[model samples]
Target: MGLFNKFFKGPEIDQAKSDANRSKMRACFDQAVENGTEYKLAAGYTEDVSRFNYGLVHGSKSKIGSLIVGWNEQNETIVVVPTTPDLDECSNPVYYRRSEIYKAYRNKYPTDAFIIYPDKKGYIAINIFEWLEDESNYIYIDQEAEAKAFTDFFMNHFKTK
Candidate 1:
């Protein structure tokens, strides 16, 4: 079993998923290469460990960000570079606190949505995919304009490959 499968629990490695890689949800391994940013699937880059994080290879020196997305097809995965990291927006408390793509949905949808609050460790109770479910409150901000101010702030500083 894959590391993510152990926790995330989704489709297993198979041919159908392999064929899915050609679709909108290309794996991170491909997007990082396309964006000209440094990165690899699953591995984050480190000075001592080059192979560990291929994504960080050609990454920006100023920004630290990552987006673990799923290429539902073929069950492959893609990791886009987010506009910015959460901590960087710390100066603006409100932005850092409740500023997420889901906010846009909350502003639009009329319901008591279940907002997943970060815990004491600064990590949410689940993986990033938890925020990507369609029925769930998760929001995917693809367009720069669609992003909230906080997201825009991060995007402004970080360069997409």
Candidate 2:
């Protein structure tokens, strides 16, 4: 019975860990937003696209950290908070305004801006660009439904004027 269950279930979801991570993310978001209203939040592993490779030089994906993205309604901004395993090494929260996000969405070079697509490992990759620095990063979500929800929330807010 144990073997059968293991085979059928694959692996059990770690509810406790998930809850803890969510709490940490909420705290970070609150600190960044202050009194702003939250529209959406999603958790995933993040990587800098520039440093990522296809396993030729190094690994296919170089994960910098785990992160949670939150949409702040009060200031019309998107806040990304790093929930890296190594707390001391975590980067600061990055804020992207609605206008800047929209500009990236409508960029002349589509590959140079915000885009979401499936990764080689069956995860969903959401790419976000920092226009000023010309840098791009990606968040890889394990669940397709969650990725869709995140993308939908982002598009609804930042895809238009």
CA displacement after TM-score superposition, residue 29 of candidate 2 (Å): 2.3
Q: Worst 10-residue stretch by lDDT in candidate 1?
A: 86-95
What would you estimate as the lDDT of candidate 2? 0.50
Question: Candidate 1's error at 36, in angstroms?
Answer: 6.6
User: How many steric clashes between backbone atoms does each model show?
Assistant: 19, 0
Q: Write the per-residue lDDT of candidate 2 for residues 58-134, one digit (tens) a residue.
A: 54445454566666555667666665542223356667776544242323353323343222233223443211111
Candidate closest to the true structure, highest TM-score? 2
Q: What is the C-alpha RMSD of each candidate to the true structure, in Å?
A: 19.9, 9.7
How well is each residue in 1-161 modelled by candidate 1, as lDDT tens digits?
68877889863444343234222223333433444233222211111112334665653232223332212112122223332222111111111223222221111133222122233333211123212222112223222221232233223332122
Please identify model 2 stretches exceeding 4 Å from their true place.
1-6, 36-39, 49-61, 73-75, 86-90, 105-146
TM-score of the candidate numbered 1?
A: 0.18
lDDT of each: 0.26, 0.50
